[model samples]
Target: MGKILRAIKKIIPEPIFDFFSPVYHWILSLLAAVIYWFPSRRGRMKVIGVTGTSGKTTTVEFLYRIFTDAGFKTASLSGLWFRISDKSEPNLLKMTMPGRFRVHRFLYEAKKAGAEYVFIEVTSEGIKQYRHKFIKFYAAILTNLSEEHLEAHGGFENYRRAKGETRI
Candidate 1:
């Protein structure tokens, strides 16, 4: 599946690819949620979405520490790592907010692993791509917003709007 998608990306023209990107992202997000049995909607854990141009990783790490210190089972997904309780691995993908399948699968795994809470470091790019669509967030934290990714987002207002959609 991955190879096929990669091939398609290689073949498509940039303009066409950009035009259909949103639809593709939305479909994948819905499909991923269905495949994962909509983990976030199952009420298995409190999913907190942290969004901002900066400070998202730091905030997620701090929350993870606080929750773990208090003896709560917690999972956190950040730019730096993917952690479930005491077990963790480096985020080699380099995507702060990965694709929909990854996000949904992570939530499903965290829930199955007995996580009481899950903290996800949300990014504007992720939201713009519909990666944050199906997840039902228990809470949302906006650390701060600034002019970042201006070209990719078209402008600061668009970036801010994307950040605003991190929850729900």
Candidate 2:
């Protein structure tokens, strides 16, 4: 019986090894779209995007604090938290990047909550996958560049291109 099960597993393609992968991602993308679209249709929002090898979280937090202090309703998605228009809490994402659609969704939710401003921490990998495509930024802060995630990006030049592409 064990041998039969093993044989069945071996016969299955590696890509088909996880049956839930496609369904899971589809659900997530749909959720993200719903969250972003509803609030955006209501009014205009000022979006601030921060991308770098380090200090993304700190920079986002600083901007959040400043915006809130100025009395604007603000929402921020950083390494530490997923904030929705003055209602911030710890990020519960099981995966670091979550999904390609998550950032857009979070922005959508913030907009729904009447957030005047939104801040996001854009990662190099996310940029590579074209996750930052949909959202328009009012301002972008590029803190600094460094070497990281060389394996996925192939080399330093590819990594730099991944980061630099975000600016265009």
Candidate 3:
């Protein structure tokens, strides 16, 4: 799919690509959810989403530690790293919230690993792109919101709305 997207990007003009970008992301997100069998739903895992203009990674990290220390199998995807229980690796993707398929795949893997809880660092851009879709969040935390990503989100209000959109 990655290769296919790259090929399409090369073939399509920038304007055309930009016009269809949202639809593309939406389809990919829904597809990923279906392919992963909606791992976070049906009470399969306690998915906690941490979103805000700042401190998302820190919150996710703290939650990961808290859950693991309490003897609950835990997984986390943050800007700094990705962890599954006792093992963790740096997040080389340079993305706080990864693409749709990657997000769903991680949730699926966490469920397979018997993780009781999963902590995810959500971002406003990710929510705008529908990357937060299909995950049944048990809890949603907004560390803090400020005037950031105004340009990308069009305005502060839009950015704030995007932050709130991550609740599901």
Find the number of clashing residue pairs for candidate 3: 0
- How close to the true structure is residue 61 of candidate 1, measured as C-alpha lDDT? 97
Q: Rate the local accuracy (lDDT) of all candidates.
A: 0.92, 0.73, 0.91
lDDT tens digits by residue: candidate 1, 76-105: 999999999999999999799888899999
**CA deviation > 4 Å runs, candidate 2:** 1-42, 94-97
Q: Candidate 3 overall Cα lDDT vs. reference?
A: 0.91
Positional deviation of residue 166's Cα in model 1 after best superposition, in angstroms: 1.4
Pairs that collide, model 2 = 36-108
Off by over 4 Å in 1: 1-17
lDDT of 2 by residue, 51-102 (tens): 8788888999999999889999999888789887557778787533445566
- Candidate 2: count of backbone clashes, pairs at least 3 residues apart or interchain: 1
Q: Write the per-residue lDDT of candidate 3 for residues 9-93, one digit (tens) a residue.
A: 9999999998999898789899999999999985568999999889999899998999899999999999998899888989999
Ranking by lDDT: 1, 3, 2
lDDT of 2 at 106: 75
Q: Count the backbone clashes (under 3 Å) in each candidate.
A: 0, 1, 0
TM-score, candidate 2, is: 0.73
Model 2 weakest 10-residue run by lDDT:
20-29
Candidate achieving the largest TM-score: 1
Best by lDDT: 1
